[model samples]
Target: MNERSPVRICILALPETSASVVYGMYDMFMSAGRDWGLIVEGTPGRAPIAPLVVSRHGGAFIAGNNVRITADAPLDACDDADVVCVPELLVPPGEPLAGRFDDEIACLRRCHAKGKILATACSGAILLAEAGLLDGLDATTHWAYCDFMSRQYPSIRVRAHRALVASGDGERLIMAGGGTSWLDLALYLIARLAGIETAMQTARINLVDWHDVGQQPFARLARTRQAEDAVIARCQSWIAEHYAQPSPVGAMMQMSGLPERSFKRRFQQATGMSPLAYVHTLRLEEAKQMLETDRQPIEAIANEVGYEDAGFFSRLFRRKVSLTPAQYRRRFGAMRDAIGCISETR
Candidate 1:
């Protein structure tokens, strides 16, 4: 908060957690405000982040990959910290984390209740999901785990292709997708807690880059899940669930509480789509899911996704999705059936 008082960041360490992520985050956080100024201007700047590692107990232990770690404090000692971050954990996707982290999960709940900003990188999100903290909140993890996460926690809107996601009330729950996107998460946290200038300086000093293009390309999927703007992010999440409602764009504009022109501009900037286009994308995505999994009539699917006229919906589907509604269903629906059969045989 001040020059002398840095943002206290507590990193949770577990036996299954990777040491590289833990220490990589530690090094970057330690250099937040202090490195760039000294490197360029030859004057030391105030350190913006003070990182502390905490484990289940109050001592040293070996991590999953045989790396020894010493904790600065136990989980109970984290009350003084401003934010608690969970680096990647090496748990298997779809594996239940039922009894492994009772103490760690409780600590997170307590910290979140006290309004401490809670964050996770990669499969560390599983711990947050295990804590029931992500209930009814949009979230993401490594792409491979997206389906497992959705299946395990149905209340969570799993954004598989999003490299980063900020959800929950006040957007206090932050998560990053697989790999080095944790650097982006750290920079974003510094920007949120300290200042954007310091975050930029940290990036410049560390030679780290933001993953602006997101993980969809990596996951071999596509779409815009951009949400750098907090207000626009909230509106986007709102419209995701309510896309089937009448006049959804107007509803999002109202939810954003911005002037018509301002809301339109910000929405476009935040997502690469106009307000109407954004709503249409969401509706079409839902229609695709329904078509793949259900045998409902095309008219029914169209109407359910907020399109009243079946003919108009068919035209738009072809124009935007490059396939007729029936054609899209026949292709992907068969794929789904084949996948189901394959799974059954296996």
Candidate 2:
């Protein structure tokens, strides 16, 4: 940050916002052009990016995880900030936010209209979509919300595979994918506003790695939440415990005590998926766990998860999970072992 003055960044804090994302961005932003100097040299450099958390109505509030959060200023009073960020909002997909965050949404639009670079970590992109600022631009959010955002806001092109996206008028609107991909977002912002050298230094100091695989591999193909319909719920519970059995979907249909057409329609209505799709989801999820934790033969594992043909299973796994079964095992198994090694060292 060779700029004469600090980069002013205002983080828009909202209800149910994750405390970690908000404060983590704040810390990283404040550290940019500052922390590296402190660690390498005896003297501390002046912070390059000045960050403040501003809420719609400035004050103290509880976050989604019951942690207390305090805003630095009100949104209306934050016109001077060069960058405005929306931290991860603990919003569930498919939940309507029609009457909520009206003030915050309007403020975001005004800031972007005034040429302020707007960014969001994870689910916070929902606000940008609601504000209509991302229309005609490529955008992304948490994997869980990608489909919902696309269905709800058809104008914006939702890129579900990318972990980070930057698109809008002049590419001022940026977003990061689920969870700690915010680290990547912050580093990119630092590089954009400060310098690439500073961003690289910050990444090295924080030991942050990029999520190169994107979000598709982490996304589940089908919903697992219980359905509102009692019959569908019973069928789901049955299938959960018997997904490996042959004709699992048929067994569920029989257990549901409904005619074939009625059962399929009702199951689709209740779960947003067909019966066979739901069964496939259950089987794949179980197979993923086995791949991550065990060294069993792929054929045996496939058989155990209700797939008789290993070739068919491999193709299905690749199609649904964006990774071959063997690839998934190598990736997750190595990840698990790395975590264990890190834990042991600690």
Q: Name the top TM-score candidate.
A: 2
Clashing residue pairs in candidate 2 (N, C-alpha, C atoms within 3 angstroms): none
Instruction: Tell me how candidate 2 scores on lDDT.
Output: 0.87
Off by over 4 Å in 1: 220-346
Give the range of the ten consecutive residues with the poorest summed lDDT in model 1.
217-226
Clashes by residue pair, model 1: none
Worst 10 residues of 2 by lDDT: 216-225
What RMSD, rounded to one decimal, does every model reach?
14.8, 3.6
lDDT per residue as tens, model 2, 1-346: 4557788899988777988889999999988878888899966777788899998789998887898889999997668888999988787787899988888888888898899899999999999999988888899999888867887888999988889999977789999988888998999999999889989888888998878777767876444667889999988878888988999888888898899999999998777568898888788988988898889999999999999899999999888777899989999988998999999998
lDDT of each: 0.86, 0.87
- Candidate 2 positional error at 10, Å: 1.0
Q: For residue 55, what is the lDDT in candidate 1?
A: 85
Evaluate model 2: give its TM-score: 0.82
Name the lDDT value of residue 344 in candidate 1. 100
